[model samples]
Target: MRYFLTLYILAIVTLIGVAGFRGDISRKPPIEVFPDMDRQMKLRPQEPNAVFGNERSSQPYVEGTIFRGMPYQDTPINTGRISGTTNWVETNPIELTVERMKRGQQRYNIHCLPCHGASGDGKGITSKYGMVAVANFHDARLVSMTDGEIFNTITHGKNLMGSYGANINIEDRWAVIGYVRALQRSRLATLDEVPEAMKAALEKE
Candidate 1:
């Protein structure tokens, strides 16, 4: 009975020490067994922060920082391949349209035309410089590659070609790809595929 009474008293003391007397105002902060990061130092935008010399929480963008809704997401749209797999996506993720095609054409002219040529026939000005290694898009090997494979090539660069990933943003890279597809289609499109008006005019020739 004596031991039980002593243990009961100790328990009561422990409970009070841990939780404090009910309704009693305590000067000390409450003990948190599991803090769960309830309180933490954080930098708020536009707030005064001593960490930076300017005393501004806001900071300039770091070089090469690409803005993304989900910075770590692994999707075909971002990676040019199916998420969690090594296989390349079979087609461009961006919707094909005249505007997108025009954007692609513009970017391609700026970047790819130097080597791949205006016609994408591997006859760009670099040919005159004795640079014979540039790839011709119409070749059977290149034509057979999937869109994702081509995107990977554009992003990382294939043999002899340097990576354009740094120069081209993700969406623009896909745009350039869409333009390349149009170029490829230009070579293989059947007369039946031509617009009726254009077909009639061609037939007149």
Candidate 2:
């Protein structure tokens, strides 16, 4: 019985030593086992590189390269697709009479008034947000501008304003220009020179 007891104690001690060496023992003080644990903690920001995949390669304008393997289509103003010197349409083909002026007014009110103001005074709701200042359509410099010049400005956009070619069709843009001319005329017209019909119409209202 004594011999058997001695052998059992020896086996238990050997097993415990093996477990401690292999880190299998639990509930031991961590400080005593790993004194350098404080030096092992670290944090790092992730790199900006995207993962490699078919989807990443398919995106357009990725890393400044156009994807989809298609040629870039240049917009009108961006690449001067339309000649700058050439007239957009015939000049002085027909006078901008009252009827054309009325149509132009309607188109301008629908599209331009929100940013250019009903009076072309550069005051619009969007202007309050610090966006590019809209030019006063009634400025003397603008008043002297040719109809074709005005059309080009509207189509190609000047300065901070983007081109309206995509939004307003060519014909409508021309009509708006005619309307702007009429507005300028009205602002500068002498009271005595007002058309009799227009004078009467104003009094009736």
Candidate 3:
């Protein structure tokens, strides 16, 4: 009974010792019951290390390592051009579908409509803010460019334009290309190119 009472007193005193200490400043390291790999021995990036000759802790990526989620199988789809050649892909690799066009329209409006306008006429809202030299899709030079060239331009950027690659993904880029084509065709359409049903509606108007 005496030993148990003494143990209880000791426990109470220990608890008091732990709980009584509270302050804004702490000089001791934090108590971690579970370290959880927090203090790894591995050297941090750019840390001086003798293992590498230059003492850099970082190393180059493994040879032939393709980055995650980066596509390399379809050259034309991934890069918008054939391998080892400057020839641009004449047509979009993805099939034209209503859903795809809708998505393309959505992407274009978000990323491109600010500069290219709704009709791709180079008179977008940015023009009102003193931006000049926006390219018109209806222009003969742009119309003559193949799908691949346009995709490359979008990926790498052209004069006075920045690359949209970081802003859009691979598939979305193709969709935007398709939508741009539609915009161009609409602006340059002739009576013969219009479908007969549409032509009837147009003639009525």
Candidate 4:
């Protein structure tokens, strides 16, 4: 009984030592595990500093400069619309070459597969974890959407989706759209669309 009582007192002391003063205010500076980050010598925005000739911590963006790996124009490639018009383009402005399609596949696997799925069926891994309303490329509405409209969706995002324009470059954005079209076509394609060289083997089956 004595040993247990002593142990209980020690445990209470330890608990109080660790947590009793958590909410108390202290004047002394707290010990920092990483002092460099805790006291970083960095400029704060909108604050006056002597670093620049203007003595301003915040500076205006340089003229004629766009964000790196981004496009900010109304051209067909950037806007995914008819040049100088509000209408969406029916076709991708960039040529959908084999290389671009391959690149699309790669980029799609990285950025899209997590939510859009490998088949573009919107049944990606996230769906199992309660992510809802992922857009399925095979849907009729998406099938009928113009390539430019799809590009716009990727650039600006829609509904629950967020903008990928900052993340995906212009060329690659078009490439991802091209790859999505290919995925949609995959489910709708007929035997006639198959290559003559491989038609014999499929027909034999």
Each candidate's TM vs. the true structure?
0.65, 0.49, 0.64, 0.66
Candidate no. 2 TM-score = 0.49
lDDT of 4 by residue, 1-205 (tens): 9999999999999987755677777676776889998888889999999989999999999998678858456788879888778999999899989999999999999989999999999999999999999999999999999999989888889999998988999899999999999999999999998999999999999
Instruction: Look at candidate 1 and tell me the lDDT of residue 118.
Output: 93
Report every candidate's CA lDDT: 0.89, 0.68, 0.88, 0.91
Candidate 2 structure lDDT: 0.68
lDDT of 2 by residue, 1-205 (tens): 9999999999888977656656466785544466566566333234232544432423334476666647335433322233444533324224567776687789899888888888888787778888556888788888777666676677778887778877876656767877776777779987578788688877666
lDDT of 1 by residue, 15-119 (tens): 988888789898888777768776767887889999888889998999988787545478998887899998999888989788989999999999999999998
Question: Residue 155 error for model 1, in Å?
Answer: 0.9
> Of 2 and 4, which scores higher on TM-score?
4
Give the winner by TM-score. 4
Instruction: Please estimate how well model 4 matches the true structure, expressed as its whole-model Cα lDDT.
Output: 0.91
Model 4: pairs clashing at backbone N, Cα or C within 3 Å: none
